[model samples]
Target chain A: MMIKLEQLVPRPLKDRLSARPSDIWNTTLTLEPGNIVKIKAPSGSGKTTLIHIIYKLRQDYDGSVYFDERPLPAIVENELAIVRQTQMAVVFQDLRLFPNLTARENIDLKRILQTPLYDAEKIDEMAERLGVKHILEQQAGICSYGEQQRIAIIRSLIQPFSWLIMDEPFSHLDNNNTRLAASLIAEECKKRGAGLLVTDLDEDSNFDYTHRYQL
Target chain B: MRIQILTTRIDINFERAMRSLNTLLKKLIRTATGRKRFVMAFIGLSVAMLLILSAVQIQVDYNDLLNSKTNQDSIANFLVVNKVLTDRNLGATSLNDSEIADLKRQGFVEAVGLLTPSRFKASIQSASDRFPFFTDIAFESVPNDFIDVVSKDWHWDESSRFVPIIAPNMFLDFYNFQFSFSQNLPQLTQTVVKMIVFKINVYTPNGIMTLNGKVVGFSDRISSLLVPQEFMNWGNSRFANAANAKPSRAILRTKDPGNPTLVSYLKEKGLATDADKTRFSRYRHIVDLVVKIAWVTGLLMFLFAMVIFTLFIQLTIASCKEEIILLVTLGASPGQLRHFLVRQFFPVNVLIVLISMIMITGLQYGAHIWLARQNVYLDTWLGPTTFIAAAAILGLIWAVNRVTIRKYIRLSTN
Candidate 1:
């Protein structure tokens, strides 16, 4: 699977962030499977907005983003749901977990909808490696920011996907925890032959990305 | 053993939570159940009253029509055709066989009936009467379907001891208002008439034979006193002179009495029947007005109940908006949400309908029994019309509730 962006220009709003020089707004880009790419940008460079538009979550833009040669705007709702469920996974910057649910349940909620793509044992194994196994049984709202970030990352990786998109996933983590979460994400991507698109303000030595872009 | 049981229980809990989002939905419904019941009670009571009132209204009007004593012309398509009297005629006009055959051949007439004159002279006397009352009576009959009085006793047998008679309602009015006023006697009601049997003495060629006569019913449409056609034919054959017998009146059943051809043909033949046709028209208009008014009132009540029901649904859905949004974001379809709503609301409405119908039916039966003790017999059960009407209203409530709940779910998701 591939996602292609062509001459995309978002309708600029005053409150939302947009890239400097507006050059990235008029560019064309493509993301292929099994490739790790880093999008390096400043704090207010519309990074999260770009990720949202590509994931078919936002449509306030001028040009097209195509999924397998079909435009995102034209894809039917059921097909988009299937793609989101089994082919594309995302970790938003806000860690959109149900506050009433446990940290383990936040991840298990996505897994339960699919046909047992990842079992409870696999989930426990991932949580153990990411150093969040002790906090798994606690309510997600009461957990620390760094711990919840790791839980959101684990939740995104529990389902099958051709592309795992992360928007500032390790923003709240220290170097050691960031490296641990990055290692787990890379290993899971390699196992499934999926691509990685991670957005961050600066580079860290955890990931040996295949390609890099600046916004 | 305790550790193993604890592990198994955990697994069951996990499985139940993983199946669907019904756990969350159940929690939401439980929280709002009290408020929902309070609102639904008002709607249910309104609907129940609407149904009961409509059913009672229909039954009462039906009974009124059944027992009405007004002279309703055009109740049947048949018109009584009699020869119009003129100054030049000093005697009664007789309709011969050829005239009846000609009337039958007319294009507008569906069928024709001829009146048969009684051959024997008859007189009536009662022990309560100060003087004997005698009359020359004739009997005319159409098909049994044409008779409006619904009674099973409208039959005759030659060997029977008592003669069952149907008399014109006007004859009773004349006796009560005019004759009884002039004389110092008591007036009679239909119930009293039904109870009094007169002694009839018939003057036959052989001798005078005494028979018992009982009035069975009264008809406003036919001006002459009526007897069963079978008794009249047998009596006429046994007593009357065959050569001189003729029918002076003819009854013709027409497809449409207002048709110009039929009217002009009757005019050409100098035949006329009842002239008070406007009274029948007014009676029909009144019946229609009563029915329409009842329907409109019932419909307004139903709409008001529906409004209350819809508000209740909207409130319940609004309270569960957060849970609904969570479910939708988890990839639950709108159709699934609709199925959930239907499952929740359908059984409640069904219970309401069943309970309301039972109460209304009980009320009807109670009224019937009480009235029967006072000598009035009403139908003892709710009719199919009541059931059908209730079903229609319930189905409407279900449909509207489904749509409103589904819309709220979608709006919350968005």
Candidate 2:
């Protein structure tokens, strides 16, 4: 599956936002399966908002988004839920973790939501690689911010997705942890032959990208 | 291959998950514990109101009154049918031979007897009283078959000049309670009154004769004083002015006093009856009104309970808004959320209804036993109408809960 953004221009933020050049603002982009795309922008430049619109989480944008030539907004809610469950996975900037649930339970919720349920061993292996296994049994709310971010990343990777959308997922992680998390995500994407869209403040050498866009 | 297998299992898993998830949701809500008190209090209040309304809506059995009035030899099957007196026909109220024949022809009437008025002029003089008290007395008689009580001693003997008289039961009550107290005389029992003798004087223009009179029995059926047919016939021949007095009232016996045909027939013929069973019809009307009022009040109480329950649910959802939003974002369908909320509320409603029904039934049974001890018989359970009404109200509560929860979930999801 491919996500095509046609001449996309997001609804501007209410507060301060860095001005986008006309060419970049009006650019059309398509992130296809197996393609790695990076969106770099200054803080508050609607980078998260662009990812949200592609995920159908927000609709306050000027242009249309098509998930494999089907208009994103026209899909019904249940069908969209199905799409989100099996075909798309997102790691939100805020993690969106249920504070009352342990990290393992949070990840298990996403794993059981889709087809070919991920085994517990596989989840623990991924958590071990990202250094979140130690805190996996603790409630997400009581865990450190960096530990919560790793738990959120593990949750997103356990689900089957044709596209993995990350909105500043590694923002709270140090360089060592970021490189480790990036490598695990890359390995999962390569195994599934899925595309990746990672939004951040500046370009990093953690992922070798097929295309780059400024928002 | 994996997606195919998973898709095949989705239906089964979804069903199992819904049940499991609802159980889990109940556990989660139960932990909140803040709203349980309010829910329980409202449930108790609603159940109490329902019990009362259900008890009232039940029909009363008038036969219970018969069972309780065992000492009263009530000839309830007999009705005293009389005609309306009018100025145009001053003697229209008299029961003539034609009217008695017409009454007997009716299918509902089993028997009819014309009342015979006394032919003799008579007055009673009390023998047991310190001061001699004499009062004019009237006598009426029907056939010996119509008399509720019969004894050989009730016969009159012209040779001995002894007459046995049947008096009204109310007359005994009046004398014992009112006259006896006011006159500083002893209140007499039925047995004691039976032992007293009286001087019944039969007077004519030719001569006045004194005869021995004794109280034979008390009649609850007849309000006026009565004498044996033989005595009335003999006295009328000797002292009466040879005028054949037309009977004014007739006693009619029916199979069922509440038979609508009897009432309609009486209405059509402009006849009236002074039977105790007629009052039961009026009593039934009053009971019907009472039941209606109770049902209306119960429905209002149910509405009030619904409001309380709805508020409890609203508070519950509001407290858990964050968790609900998180679940929605995790691809949980609106159906899942609805199932969860419904599970939370439905049990409380079922428990309330069941407890209310059981308590109401038990209360009715207790009341029946209590009344029976006091020689009063009453129906002992919630009637079918009450149960149906309760079931309907319970169903409405469930429906309202579903709709309200669905709406709230939709808003949260959106």
Candidate 3:
């Protein structure tokens, strides 16, 4: 099933409006299964806002989001998380790692999360693949910045998800690291038959533009 | 279909709630382990305080009520006096046989006997030895205290032809030994004994009494020796007995021989005793005082403790609000957050219930033991039953705390 957003935009935007009346009030986009697309915009653009929309936080918008070709316009409240879990994963820019949990603990959060029973072998494999196997037991806060960022990405990617969403995920990575992360993410999405929607201006990595929406 | 949907939704919610609870529990443990001393203090104090107060009091009261002397009802004798009725004709006196038949038919009485004076010169087949002359007293079949009035025998006595009944003061008074009582009365209570035949007298009524009666077959206390009214009648007729008379003195037994109730029932039936009135009143007063004290103490303690507990919980919840808000912000739904709060407080409630039960048991023990010392007895007070009660009490307390926490959520939402 594909999700299509027609003329979606923000409301009066009381908190984030540091400027005058804006015409970026409406925009249309089509989100399909396993489609790798990016919404490219400047730093201050509402890319994160757009991402939060899919997560159903800022719902004050005039958009028709169709799922399975049906207009899921009202956005069933509790089911939004179900949609997020089976349909999307967001690697937030802040890397909200629970400070109390170790790296391995952080990765294994999905086990204690919505799902019951996480596989130990799968967790170990993901940790090894992300090159964080050695530092799995270390407290997340004590790890270096790059290590924290990698752990965050690995945590997000470790679980099986049908859609991948990110807000400036590569902001802290070099070109080579970005390429490696991109390749790894692509391999993961391809294997799961997942869709990808990323919003960032990481121009140097030169992602073969699947599709781009300018904000 | 609607039922099916509701079921499915409930199932999913149940699952979500479980996961949410598990997550919150694990988080609480991880966080709480760093501050073990605080938890230990709260739990330890709660247990100790509750156990001491609750358990001990329950034990003491329960014990006292059980072992008291008159636990079951009782019957008290108020005034029992030996008196007789007489007709001023021939001095011979005895209860008329027809009256005995009438009393027998009444049927509310136990055993009826003729309680003759010890000196009564009547021969009973059940007696061990033969009684002798005027001064020869027999304790076998009569009230021993009547010997003091042994001065008289009621018969035209001192003659072998007619024997007198050794009826002591009662016979003399009833047959009117001194002329004003009865014109044909026996003269000189004793000298008249050998001269004429005197008869023993008795009146007894009928019923089954409710005392856990002593085995009459073998009880040391026998209030009255029974002279069969049949025998008394035979003697009265055969001796051409003294003046005719009416049946006068006999005792009746009643039912339900226990406190307040027994007294009232007996009073209602015209069988109450003066002693019954006094004892019943005392019991009512003492029971009323105990009940009033228990209720007043229980209410005051409940209200004061509840208020303090509510305020303490309000403060603790307020302090932990930030932690709750943080969880909410992290994509925790309202349901999840509520479950988290409930789960976090789970251990606290368990500790409270456990401690309350322990303390309640102790109180019941004290009550039971105290009552036992005072001779009280009971089978149950603080076993599984008390644990259930404590759990219910704690559950209600927890529910109240949770209801208050919703306001915190509403404020945070706003």
Candidate 4:
């Protein structure tokens, strides 16, 4: 109900090699709910730059991003936070799962913040489907790298979002991990109907052909 | 059609920066050394404030009462007694015969005493109504309205036309008392019920005041003798020697003044009740300063404590900055996060206050026994109820004002 920021715009394609936070921001791309789109870019090649711009963190550069189809020339921090709450979900490269918290607690935060939770069974089923049910009771920090990565995706997947962004979520994984992580993330996105944006994985990477696109 | 694979409640992405203060309070409370350190620090501050403020009050009250510039009357300098030491009906009204014998054997007291207020008729004339008149001239004003608290002076309309309760030093009775009710007169007998009154020798309208108030005391006015104790006793003897039945007033003396150390020695013996102590001789000015300092010091200390507490909360949320960023991405509103944090940190200080206040109060209650004296007790004399209320209210207001979780919310959104 609360509209925070409504516009964001990226600078013209100039120099294209500047390292400032604002220089790399891309234009506002409003994906429909559950619209799964991938922004493919090499590591450190500005894939995250696009995510940062859409999320309202790269305020120093060029171009405008819009919220609700309106122009957001620059999104301030507080408004960005509200935007993040209602319309965004992110899968970070480092698997930002709270190490101290258990898988249940990590999931519980999502439900706890919502009015009446989305559904406890959904979390159980998601964990089971991802083969993380065995380690669901364990501390995320102590979990194996693959397990941590899965749990991070699971936590992000459960949120109600208008946009979902992944920052090289599967870059370091072996071929097996890359495929498993992508398939699992794709399935959850299709179920929720939130826009999906992914980066870092190459053509040979295990990603859905329909959603992949180079930045 | 772009197809999202997983579910999400987030609308937008966000990043938050966390920085906290007062981190050590947590670690401090959890361990024995830390807990003891804080408690000791609290008590030390309390004691410092109490002693310094009280010493100043004693110094001030001394100047006012004595008009003496020397003004630094310590508790030991005066023979103070509780105006109501025997009035509370504390069940210790009359000592058992054995107890009396024990006290008598102590040899320090020439006698033990009691008195009741007796009123019939008396006349007084003042050179000028300009001089203030008090209802009970013996005691000063109570500090709080609706709360009978002791202070330097009562600001009442001394407009009433009654024999203002006999002042210990002022006004002139110019009359002598034949004390019949006294058990012992330093110059006479003890264990007597015969009534008498002390005649006041006032130099008013007149020349010099020569009475040192040795014949009068705390019980002197509250006795059945409306007349001055000295006046009544001497007058009674005169009337009896002269064969007269119409003695104008009654007087009773509980102890003999043969030993000047009677009042101080009795008080030390625990004869005074909490409510009974009406005056302190530590320079009225000094006492005033002491009480004021006690109040002001307490107020400021609590204020400082509150700010520190609030900083602790801000620090806690700051520690969780990254988690905050993640939550925002999960579609949790800024209000929701704040609402949760508010719920989280509010009780931290609340717990501290609850536990600390209880312990402080218990300690004060125990310390009050020492505080129950006419002069310079605890640097200030506060009743248990008043003390508790002050501590609670101070803690509450401080807790409420110092919280700044809203700042964390702003930073996170930023």
Candidate 5:
């Protein structure tokens, strides 16, 4: 599925964005399926806001977002859940995991949220690759920021999705862990022929991106 | 065939996955926080349901006892009704035609037969000197339907040699217990009395006339000497009298003599009947009072229980508000959450209903056994109406749970 943003600007950042030109904020952009897209921005640039807008979480925006041909707001609540479960996945910048749940449980919840897109054993596989396997049984609340970020990345990859949205997914990770987590995400996206939209502070060689935009 | 096998395997996997998911949801939504309140609500609901269902069962059992053929012999369905004899209306105690019509119009009265009294003076004497007895007597005749004795010889015509009579069993008891001992006469059995022939003398304006009368049957329903309606009509018309006297009493056929409405109707109309027959109405009134008390208290308790349950649900949902929002954000649909909450709460209601039903069944069976010793047979099982009431209450609980869950889940999600 392709995500099309039409002249989008966050209401909170509308005035700030008018002072500077952006390649994405006020412009129409379509992230086609199977293409790895990178959005680079400084802090307070509405990068997370843009992701929330596309994810249909925050509707306080000026313009419309479409999943393929259907407008975001046109999808009802249950249909939106289906889209989130099967068509679109996300790793929030805050790493939104149930704090009381163990890291493994947090990821397993997503895996079983719809159908079993991957076997239950796959959680261990992804956790092991990202080097967070030892902390998988630890509660997300007590886990270190870096460990929780890797757990969040594994959670996003555990489900079936055509578009994976990440907002600063590696902010808490070290360089080595970031590369490992990035490779795992790239591999999962490549295996499903799914698109990736990652927002971060600066340009980095995470994956060979088909398009890069300043948000 | 290969595709079908694959589909079945997928279905099994899906089922397993959903089971795990539900377990996780149960862990997250900790309904155990208000355990005390839940237990209290459960107990309240059980007691309420018990009261309500027992009321239904008691009514069913009472009806069965009154109308069941096995208990019919103990209770009389026919009653001889009359106006209460008061000094002011001493000679005017006879019921008017309109009063009889009004009695017929009552829903509880199945049939009314006016007791037509003989207008002329009459006397009865034994035909043989072996039992020489003579007494001034009056005869009353009622319609054939109101007669309880099934005697084939109870019909009369102009050519008949003897008039058939039905003496009240009370009179026989009076004679056997009191009259015979006091007068030094032999106590006669019913068969011996039936075999005796007697002379009936009717005094007319012209002269005295004599006819033969034979006792054909004995009745326990009406407490009077009953003759055939044909004889009474013929005797009253041929013998000289002032005019046809209005009927002072009437026999009523009712399905349930214990009905309170019939009793109240009798009192309201200034009519009277054999108090022994209508004594069942007093017990009925008590049962009615008990049943009504059970109903009102049970319904009030049920309402309070529902309120407690709804508040408990709201409290649980409120406490987990943040978690629910995050869960929804993580793609748990409102439908899923609602289903999970329903599973959490609704099974206990079903269990309560089932437990109440079983208790009522046990009580009914016990009642049946206990009352059976008293010769009042009741069903060993509960009536269909009781089951229907239980199912209706279960359905109502389910609907309430569904609506409460939906409302709270939606509130938290939004």
Candidate 6:
């Protein structure tokens, strides 16, 4: 699926965005499938807002977003849930995890939301690769921010999707851990021939981006 | 063949996995927060259901007792009705055409047979001196359907050798107990009485007419001596000095003698019947009152139980509102949540109905055994209407649960 943005601007930052010349805001941009697109934005620039608009989490935006020629706002609730389960995945910047659920359970929920894409062992494998395997049985509430962040990433990857959207997913990770997490994400996306759209504070060598933009 | 086997194995595994997934959903949505309220509501529902179903069963049992062949009396279905004797209507107690027509029009009255009394004077005397008896008597004739006794010789005509007569059983009892003792006569049995021939003397204008008469049967329904309708018509026309008088009494064939409506109708028309036969109406009124009370009380309790159940559901949902919203945000469809909630709540309703049905069945069996010892019979099982009522109640509960679940799930999701 291709993600198309036509003159999209968040309503809260509409005035500030109009005064600036940017590659994404108030512009028509299309991120094609199997392309690693990196969007670098400074703080308070509606970076999370942009990701939410494309994911349909927030509707307070100008212009329209289309997912493969169908308007985003036209989808009903159940159909939208299908899109979320089978067509798109997201890792919120806040690392939204059920505080009471253990890390493994958190990932298992997404895996079983639809049909099983991978066996239950795949959760242990992903947790082990991200070096948070020891915390897999621990409640998400007690885990550190970095541990929760890695858990959230694994949860997003456990489901079937054609597009992966991340909002500063590596914010709480160290250099080596970020590389490990980034490599795992890259491998999964490559296996499915899916696209990745990531927002971050600064540019980095994350899967050799096919297109880089300043949001 | 190998591919087919592999696909079947995969299907089995998928089914197993779905079961586990439901278990996970159950754990996430804990319905145990309001355990005490659920128990109270369950008790209330069960009691209400029992009362309602018992009402249905009681009415069915009462009808069976009244109409069942084993419990029915052969003579109870026919009632001999007459006008109440008052001073103002002393000699005018005959029923007119309009009154008989009105009686025929009543819903409970199946058929009416007017009792035509003999208009001329009559006397009967024993033919043999060994059993000498003489007395003035009156005869009444009624339609054959109203007669409880079956006799082959009950028909008569002008060319016949003798007239057939039916004596009331009360007359024989009176003679055996009182008259025979007072008159120093031997007590006779029914077969002996039936074999005796007697002389009948009808006083006509020209002279006294003599005919032979014999008793053919004994009746427990009508009190007076009965003759065939044809004989009565022939005799009244030939030997009467005055015009035929209107009938003063009628026998009614009815399906339910105990029906309150028929009893009240007779009273309203200033008519009287054998009170012993109509004693069932009083019992029926009492039963009706009891069944109606059960219905009304059961309905009120059922309404309160339903309200409590709905409120309990709302409380459970409201307590877990944030968890539900988060679950929905994580791509849980409204349908999935509603299914899980209904599964959580609806099984208890079905269980309540089933338990109520079993209890009613047990009670019916117990009553059947107890009443059987008293020579009164009822069905050993609950009636079909009770089962239908139970099924209807379960369906109503299911629909309510579905609507409540859908509404609350939508509210939280929005």
After superposition on all CA atoms, how large is the RMSD of candidate 1? Answer: 9.5
What CAPRI class is candidate 1?
A: incorrect
Each model's iRMS: 5.0, 3.3, 5.0, 10.2, 0.8, 1.8
Model 1, span B1-414: residue lDDT tens: 999997887677556644544554454344355576556656654665556456554756364434434312354466788788888653657877787888899997888877666766777767355544666554555445555566566788877768878888999999999988897668999889877878777778889877888888888756776777887877777777555567787777765454456666777887777544323444555766777776676666666666776667676777777766654554445665677677776777777777777777787788778977876556688776777777876777788888888777777766
Give a tens-digit lDDT track for model 2, residues B1-414: 999897778766665544545553553344255557565656655665564446444533333343345423357778877776667767557767777788889998888877788867789998766755688987988888788866566887677556888888999999999998998888889888778788988888788888888888998777778888888888777778758778888887765566567877887877878645665655656755776776577666666667767777777777777677776776766676787678767877777777778777887798779987986666677567667766776787789989988877777767
Instruction: Please list the C-alpha lDDT of all candidates, in the order they appear.
Output: 0.73, 0.76, 0.52, 0.47, 0.89, 0.89
In model 6 chain B, which range of ten residues has the least summed lDDT? B12-21
Better of 3 and 5 by DockQ: 5
DockQ result, candidate 2: 0.20
Error of 1 at A44 (Å): 1.6
Among all windows of 10 consecutive residues in model 5 chain B, the one with the lowest summed lDDT is: B66-75
Name model 4 segments beyond 4 Å from true: A1-14, A17-30, A70-83, A172-183, A204-213, B1-282, B307-345, B351-402, B408-414
Residue-level lDDT tens digits of model 3 in B241-269: 34534533434332222245444443553
Candidate 1, B126: how far from true, in Å? 19
Tens-digit per-residue lDDT, B77-187, candidate 4: 222233234456453344444544555565544333323222212222323353322122121211122111122322222241221122231122211133213423223
The sequence of per-residue lDDT tens digits that candidate 5 reaches over residues A104-175 is: 899988988898888899999999899989998899999999999999999999999999999999998889
Supply candidate 3's per-residue lDDT for B244: 35
Give TM-scores for every candidate, taking all chains together and pairing residue i with residue i: 0.63, 0.65, 0.59, 0.50, 0.94, 0.92
Error of 1 at B145 (Å): 7.2
For model 6, the superposed segments whose C-alpha errors exceed 4 Å read A2-31, A60-62, B1-3, B158-161, B203-209
Comparing 1 and 5 on TM-score, the stronger one:
5
For TM-score, the strongest prediction is 5
DockQ of 3: 0.14
User: On a 0 to 100 scale, what is the lDDT of residue B299 in model 1?
Assistant: 68
Cα deviation of A146, candidate 6, in Å: 1.9
Candidate 6: clashing pairs of residues: none
